[model samples]
Target: MIIAQQKPIKEIAAMIADCKKVLLAGCQGCVAVCLAGGDKETEILASALRIMRKLEGNPLEAVTYAATRQCDPEYIVPMDDLVKDVDAVISLACGVGVQYVAERYPDKWVVPALDTKFIGGSTVHGVWEEKCGLCGECILHRTGGICPIIRCSKSILNGPCGGSQYGKCEVSKDVDCAWQLIYDRMKALGRLDKMMEIQMPKDWSKSRDGGPRRAVREDVIIE
Candidate 1:
């Protein structure tokens, strides 16, 4: 899932200070799971903004609203009425969600309340680790399910780099060598022979180098 972290209260408050009334919009998707932006978070942020404004003698009016997903046009269309009335919108979702809302509204002042992190999963109750780099190419088949592109410090496609020592990465002692993990996994699975095969250079055109990507299924489209 896409991970995100909330921006500081002071920063968020400063962004909407010019407006007398602002809308705090939250998303119930990825941000909700990360505890950055959700229904409860939106309400709490609205209250905090109100308190801050009140203490400053500005007394700003803030409203809280949540959508099933800010990334989807279907969910965002429902907020048209609420967004049209507010002076500005504080979107408590990922960067993608923020952009989606801005593109949908076009005229409304939309601001992000969270910094989009990366494609990762929760390792523990509060710990989230980066998993995929979204490099436009997936090579998990030969790597024993371990992603060297994301886990390695230097995204080496073949094997461990010279920086690998004692099964740890040269960048940090806490970091394990990605290729080492791949080797062990492959060895355990009796697939070590796969590693001998040389991998071709990644095709950069398929990635962000070309620009924004679009995936469309003709069968799913309704004329």
Candidate 2:
């Protein structure tokens, strides 16, 4: 899951000050889990924006809506009518959602309400720690499912970097060394020998370097 944190209210307030009408959109996916831009959060932000505008003596019309997903075109279709009437749109979804809205309605101004943080999962309520870096290649199979790209400070694939001490990362004492977890996991599964395998330098083309990556299923396509 991708975790995101909401932007400051003041910054959001500034973005829509010039617009007489604005739409505040939220997502029910990743942002919902992080408690940043869920349906409820969207209403909260709308209400706050209204209050702030009144306080600044520049009251403007604001509306809130939560979509099934901002990433999918089907989910965003419903907002076409609403977006057409608004001067700008403030999306509380991830970065992808903000861009999707802009792409679909190229004329409407779109602003992000949340800062896309990282790909991670919730370990506890309201606590989302990053676990993956989406580095084009996944080595989790041989690393006992722990991702070194996100956990390790340097993203060393082979083994624990010399900087690890007492199971903690040298970059930050609060962070556990990613390679340490990988080492223990491989040892328990009797696959520690796999660590000796060399990995070729990652091909940048597969990542964002070349262009947007896509997945196609020829069998699923029907004319």
Candidate 3:
């Protein structure tokens, strides 16, 4: 899931300093699970902003709504009535959600309330770790399900990189050497021979180097 962290209250308040009214839009998607931007978070932010504005004698009229998802047009469509009355919209979703709201309401001022983090999952409560580099390719088959691209500090394709020591990365003792993990996992599975095969350099074009990317499933199109 896409992880995100909320921006500071002061910074968020500054974005709509000139506006008397604003909508706090939240998403019940990835941000909800991560506890950043969800229905409850949206209300919390709105209340905080209202209190701050009241304290400053500016008194903002903050309203809020949580969409099932901000990335999809269908979910955003329901916000039309709410957008008509607000001076600006503060999206409490990821970067994608912010853009979706902006695109849906072209004339309304749209601002992001969260900083989009990486593709990751929680290790425990409140701790999220990045697992995929989103290189636009999958190489897990070659690496025993451990992603060297992201888990490896250096993003090495075939490596313990001469920098591994005591099963830890050279960059930090706290960090595990990704290659070491890969070697151990493969060996345990009796698939150590897979590591001996050289991996080709990643194709840069498959990732961000190629610019904005899109995936379309023709079968899913209603038209």
Encode model 1's per-residue lDDT on 1-223: one tens digit a residue.
8999888999998898899999889999999998889998899999999999999999989988899999887898888888887999999989888999999988888999998999999999788989898878787888898898889999878769899999999999999999999999999999899888877888877777868888899999989
What value does the lDDT take at residue 91 in candidate 3? 99
The candidate, 2 or 3, that scores higher on lDDT is 3
- lDDT (10s digit) by residue, model 2, range 174-207: 9999999888888899998888887787676776
| Whole-structure CA lDDT of model 1 | 0.90
lDDT of 3: 0.95
Return the TM-score for candidate 1, rounded to 2 decimals: 0.96
lDDT of model 1 at residue 14? 86
RMSD of candidates 1 onward, in order = 1.1, 1.5, 1.0
What are the TM-scores, per candidate, against the unseen true structure?
0.96, 0.94, 0.97
TM-score, model 2 to reference: 0.94
Q: Which residue pairs show collisions in model 3?
A: none
Q: What lDDT, from 0 to 1, does candidate 2 have?
A: 0.88
- lDDT tens digits, residues 98-170, model 3? 9989999999999999999999999999999999999899999999999999999999887889899999999
lDDT of 1 at 52: 96
